[model samples]
Target: MMDDFLTVIALIISLNAVICLYRAAVGPTTQDRVLGVNIVGTKALVVVVLVTFIQTESFFLDVALVYALLLFVVTVAVSRYLEAEGWKEVA
Candidate 1:
């Protein structure tokens, strides 16, 4: 029963990530797109953590941590890049 619940939650989070993809692709502004991507990444991280609990795999938690770090670094880097002088015009 608990496994089924986790599965449903994971599926919901995955669907939300897909919806976020549309926002990331068709957002009116670059900032919106970036925020959408960040949201999707955060959803993915939640799914990964859920999977760890559902599958009873400790390694997945490690993967989630790494994924979280990568997501943070990339988001920060992209945000910094978007804030640059030349990118301001594009934004």
Candidate 2:
């Protein structure tokens, strides 16, 4: 029962991730695209964790950790790039 639930949730997450990926690809601005990328990365991380749990494997956890680290690095890089491009605090 629990496995079935996980499978369903995984499918949902995968679907949403794909949609977010499309958003990242077609965003009107770099900042919008970066935000979409961040969201997709986050969803991917969650899906990885769920797969690890469903399969009872430690290897997928390692993959998830690496992905999470990469996601962090990419998000930070995007923020730095935006800041460098004259994007300033709007308040």
Q: Which one is best on TM-score?
A: 1
Cα lDDT of model 2 by residue, 1-91, tens digit: 9988998999999999999898888887778888998999899999999999899898999999999999999999878877785576432
What TM-score against the true fold does each predicted structure earn?
A: 0.92, 0.84
Give per-residue CA lDDT, model 1, range 1-91, as digits (tens). Answer: 9999999999998998999899999899988898999999999999999999999999999999999999999999999998888554443
Give lDDT: candidate 1, residue 40: 97
Clashing pairs in 2: none
Report RMSD for candidate 1: 1.6
The whole-model lDDT of each prediction reads: 0.93, 0.90
lDDT of 2: 0.90
What local lDDT does model 2 show for residue 78? Answer: 76
Model 1, residue 78: C-alpha shift (Å): 0.4
Task: State the displacement of the C-alpha of residue 42, model 2, in Å, after optimal TM-score superposition.
Answer: 0.4
**Distance from true position, residue 23, model 1, in Å?**
1.0
